[model samples]
Target: MWKADIIESPPGTSYRSVMEEYGYEVGKVIGNGSYGTVYEAYFTKQKVMVAVKIISKKKASDEYLNKFLPREIQVMKVLRHKYLINFYQAIETTTRVYIILELAQGGDILEWIQRYGACSEAQAGKWFSQLTLGIAYLHSKGIVHRDLKLENLLLDKRENVKISDFGFAKMVPSNHSLRSNSPYRQVNCFTHLSQTYCGSFAYACPEILLGLPYNPFLSDTWSMGVILYTLMVAHLPFDDTNLKKLLRETQREVTFPSSITIPQECKNLILHMLRQATKRATILDVVKDPWVIKFQSEQPTHEIRLLEAMCQIPFSATSNRHQSLDYHI
Candidate 1:
């Protein structure tokens, strides 16, 4: 049994020393955020390279420390999918919270687009299909990844898509269900709506931009539309420089570039996702789209079965734990 080790390092001890005690040799920093830095490390027990996000308790806000941080950990603990970054473990200390995760060596999708400039339609289709599968799995579990953008989509060594960053993710209220009996039909599953206007401005939906209570799942699909659009053009569909313009642009039709030739099927899918929130395409709808079906390798049934099996495994059985602490920044 992997026990989650939530311990406090002794006075004067460094994070590297604490990680070393847990069989991880911390290496160079790979990524950075407002309150944390992600380090590339080697886990001796597993003999594999991993990414460790070290968040400083002192720098994080009270809301983050008391609410979002715990929720992020809780959500990551249960998520298991090929297209999602695998959560290894979390070790919290007095000063820092260390989250060990699967390392996506190929870097984020944004970097790839920056380097290669827009992907070919076939390549974008593959990545989009993989992303849809991952999102479907999350929606099936009733979890909404409120943040979905090109920067959050990472790639492994094989260039396979791996969805990362769960800081803004939230589980739907217990009363509302997100699952549907048919994979092709859009079910009115969410009676309750999310008011939290979270995620990048360019990827945010019109409902969120207008401060309306929006369906979280549908908002996620809106971000997917942005991602797919970005994947094809190597740039965001809408410019987010001004709030009013952004709102106007989202409400209106999304214009495509004449420089690149995009297939009608692909354009149609993007339009469906970027349409009105009430009439937007759900994740299931994306999965069933002709372009997605052309690249999707696993059937929707396989994803459902995988999610069901993962749900059966208790969190305690998979992670180690020490004493819990109440923290406020």
Candidate 2:
């Protein structure tokens, strides 16, 4: 039997507190993130399982505990999307904060990839299209998810991808598209998204590494490119232990190994996304791309056999270059 963690609840405070007051039943720890521990909990009235992420106020800086966390909560409450994980409820006590999220029982894409090398193009196409759609939702709402990585992409039982974790997300303020919006203008994750960059090093854009103000919208596109490359090749396109060298490599041309055979249309899209050009492929380019649209119109297939098939093979040359993935400047 699993014992639930006890948390004191004050009357009429928030959704979480009210739930806690009613003897909220919690299950075993299910996941972990940079800021908190996630657990499975039951909503007695609703009788549905949910993932509860608890963040301790003690570990965070005063500024973050008071300012940033509140902002994140506010933005998340208003911003809802199909492909993004649903934020159900939040409650802040004197010592800690509890966040209720949809449970992705299928686990995260990182675990999926580690166990299974890569998904077949069909699976990849479905997942990739969904990913871009979710991201597009964030951008449309003037929110920039700064920390986008395979680890943050959660999967439900249906193999559908959910973009989670807005801990480091910025809110921009604009109805204009990212392409038309002036990057030089003040950006918020909800409003204008920042010129200052802070995200996981491995997935960060070059402008972030260069120590210059960056375009938060474009930053996401770069990470998407890295993700697209990984989906097609089962490995990172550019990786170097030396951050300096890695940045340089990313600024240059990207190449594929001779081992894998990817169609030119897919390759062209990947290359277009990975380019360091002033004008890179936008969300429209990605969605309207011949390959993506094809998958969208086709019958749904949740076949992610890429990992299961390669489980027996000993794939080499993979490293977690993100060991020091802390935010840069």
Candidate 3:
């Protein structure tokens, strides 16, 4: 329903008048990004505050408006899990586009991690489980969240992790193989679906950094590892003052702080998740991990049990490189 009537008709309506008509009161600007500015607004009827993302149509390219933005809205509309951001509406005017989204009162994970330096394993464990479920849900839907950084992981008032920002998400059907008949079929999966590599450097996977096409699922899992490490230790697992050095380091093993008191299981989980593309953990592997299970507060529900069983099939990491890479939106 939201997708069918995304673009508002009778363009050029003042934003204030539009809000009043919808029984909403616009408030302060809370965030900004390349696509738009996000404002905090009150829904008078619902008595809830929502994030209103406003995108300027004129400043965007044809492909961005017709392809990227529309695709983003479509993805958000389809995903309805608790760990993911909830979408209410998409309104496009002649001058701009407005996306009504859930507002996370706890703010982004980045700020919280920065403030606390490092969270206890008990605390991090809860967040990790939620984060993993969110990513797993995306993968199950055949959607590859190309970008997953601390900033994209938002927290609600209760500190529940809600994975957000689908600007680079690409859908690849699980059973629909692109290379079924090609000689290099298994060599590449996301080659045709997504041509460019994009993500924050610190958390990006080896395959993406090496200028090669990647399996979006595994790459997302790798980012989860980086996220876990950061949450446990307060800093990036592979941080460096030099970009070249950092890139070189990601190819090798990750280093942990000696002074920190990390559990053996936590360390092992990070090791497996942050391994080379060929040896890294799959989504199911993360869920089935003994450490993850040990730290998790309770048994997963029937749905999670089904996912764990369903994803138990074997999966290896994608091929990677050390060459310079190129990227696009």
Candidate 4:
């Protein structure tokens, strides 16, 4: 297993110097989170711009530092796809951890919606299809992205979807498999359900809100339903301010805005995904749904094969600064 390497920096050393030593010219801060900040930087050796997530060890909880952080890095390291953010390298110091990632020039989906309002069915279908493909790729590898919010779905310069933020992602045991005869059917093969509750309240599924040990894969689909709904309408399907009301809302059928017209097929797909945990649509189902397929010019078989092939190859750390160390829980 890969472990974070802790390095001791010289007295009074700055993060900038640390990054510079690794051949990265740090630029302005791009985003901020509870435990750290993301910076836009130029990798001199690679001659490409990259995003660096600088996580402060002191600010993060022990749970995150020990459990989630390691898991996130492990998951990201193995993932490689057109629709997913690529993980480049990781550097750990006494006070901080630096994660180097692909820079998506276009901002997140939430920011796009905030500025441009709701998208048309055609546009929504395209983005949703891309998102579904990314989720399918993750599911194929037995990795579940528990947090599938709009903010986590970023875009490249071409405006294609790139799934980001694997902080809440976890890999399921390899004993489970989707039925070969009916791959699109809702998956119930996993007997070992996930109990940990994570992700934003608005994007969370009913099972998660009810504090049930739920199938993490299905929970991801439910969040995708919320994202699809948000893309059609300019806002969230359920108001998250009141937990009671939010739970009640999620338990029932998702309602659409009468003011904006949505295709019947699209509505049907959303309904299938947003329903009860046992009946929710799997990632494969979403990919095969007619509404989602309408947006694709060609079949996704090639892309699916590509993702599967990529997963077979072992990931190697490219940076000399990244040295493996022993990890213990």
Candidate 5:
């Protein structure tokens, strides 16, 4: 219902032309991001449900496509993890590039977080493990997902997490594992202390903040650590007015408060993940940890139940900080 002039969203070729040429039945808007908008649309001839991501025509130059879209397609083509959203097709329009993909009914993890305070310990473990496996698979294929924030992760009808968005993702050559010449090298989100940091500023590793070159493999591990912290604690471990202060706090080893009684193994895992790049554990090792196994033995059905209950609760409600939450960051 929220329709806009196609030329306005992207310029030059009118959106009216594409609608007439492609025969697209515009439906309701489903999501929005910094670059574009996603809508649920139906192809008239094919009669199939698809998610159409329309990027601005002003920025859809061939140079931009060469720099970002192709890399995204290549990485996505190689990825087949269960927790990753699947790409169906890609179409080019006069004023926009339409990326046709699988549609997630449950929206994103950010919506769930805003509605519910946070997930239970057991629930966090399941999603945490799933994300680790998916990221490990991407690394195995030489693909690095630079942005791994809550807003970028979507969920399917089964309530399983699906990693989405590859605008910030980059592919490392088969022989190369790290970057030494990136301008953002000083930024923690670009390089970890002995590793390459390609994730969000909020979830960057300490080694990354220190401007140390880091292993590409461990970059995702650090982001996963930050995500786990947020899922359990309901807030980021480090927040600041700018990236510098954020980096400083992360480098100084900021963490959750002591009031929360997390399992020692979970606590250890979080600590291990937040350590300097040289000391951090591998994703395989973390996934294979005894604590992780014990946590996995629990039922996801129950976790989903808890998730559903929490999703119904308003974020304005007080949290169980004394027993389950860590107030200090």
Candidate 6:
């Protein structure tokens, strides 16, 4: 609910000044990853909750700024879709860069699954539509989210999904080849073709696994399909403690148990998504699936309205405290 426009960043001010201006009190560490650590913060000026990602300056190597950090910021800046996380303003100083962002109190989809087991088809379908809509919007903007997994998908208190973390994101120019050894360049014309394997190996598609230049957007669809399957079964389709065995299982087509009776529409969608590149479903094809139609018809009456409230209303200007209730406690 932070008012983005009024969030000030002044020249020569330190990181502490930036947080203090917005009345942000640093709290317990909520999460941490390679890029930085995130802290739960209370914005006193706005009387609202927010997540402040405090990026350690020491971690800001040349490779990180050129390839990872810039791309992450660019992707988030351009993506204004409903199912995507909202980025407030970034405050940079000699020692840190504090990224103020919307806080999803309900945590991520992974936690939900672990706590409640697999979701019913009706539940999975409801969430899937919102997810794909965001993905489609990203594709339209020519940005590819290389990593798409349950852990990266957060659900607000209202059960609305928000896609987060763009560390591995890529923005392909209009004329850039989807499959090529082109160098990734940022400011100052630095460039390098990626040789190291990237993204979560379990969710990675065949092209990435084979070390070929793959279309990140297309690979995401396959990962989404896997997530959909996990939501239905309460577990991953393929599982092996050994890394080699796990990769081999993922390389082959996913298989379900005999007793599980997934809906035909859901089955069709999964099959289309799991197909090899030459036969997989296109973005358009996914939107046209029958399961998607049925899924839309079944959304809880409250979900859409709550999400609209979150998107359109900023907590800073409002006198009401109920806005926070839109997220789960």
lDDT of 4 by residue, 1-329 (tens): 22334344554457899999888999999899989999999999879999999999999999999999889999998898889999888888878888989999899999999999999998899899989888887887778899999999999999999999999999877532433343332223233378999899999987778776777877889899999999999899999999989988887898998999999999999999998765678776787888998987566785455334323222332112112111111
Highest-lDDT candidate? 1
- Comparing 1 with 4 on TM-score, the higher-scoring candidate is 1
The deviation in Å at residue 190 for candidate 5 is: 16
Global lDDT of each candidate: 0.82, 0.69, 0.75, 0.81, 0.63, 0.67
* Least well predicted 10-residue stretch by lDDT in candidate 3: 317-326
Using TM-score as the yardstick, the better of models 2 and 5 is 2
Residue 97 of model 6: what lDDT? 71
- Pitting candidate 3 against candidate 6, the one with the higher TM-score is 3
Off by over 4 Å in 2: 1-19, 175-193, 297-329
What lDDT tens digits, residue by residue, belong to model 3 across residues 60-139?
A: 78888988888888888888888899888877668888888888888898999888789998888889988877776766
What are the per-residue Cα lDDT tens digits for candidate 1 across 202-239? Answer: 99988788887777878899999999999998899998
Angstrom error of the Cα, residue 190, model 4: value is 4.3
lDDT winner, 1 or 4:
1
Question: Which of candidates 4 and 6 is the stronger one according to TM-score?
Answer: 4
Q: What are the per-model C-alpha RMSD values against the true structure?
A: 9.4, 11.4, 5.2, 9.8, 12.7, 13.2
Q: Clash totals for all models, in order?
A: 8, 19, 0, 0, 12, 3
Ranking by lDDT: 1, 4, 3, 2, 6, 5
What local lDDT score does residue 90 receive in model 5, on the 0 to 100 scale? 62
TM-score of 5: 0.73
Error of 3 at 246 (Å): 2.3
Q: What TM-score fits each model?
A: 0.87, 0.79, 0.85, 0.86, 0.73, 0.77
Instruction: Between candidates 2 and 4, name the one with more favorable TM-score.
Output: 4
lDDT of 6 at 272: 84
lDDT of 3: 0.75
Q: How much is 311 displaced in model 1, in angstroms? A: 20
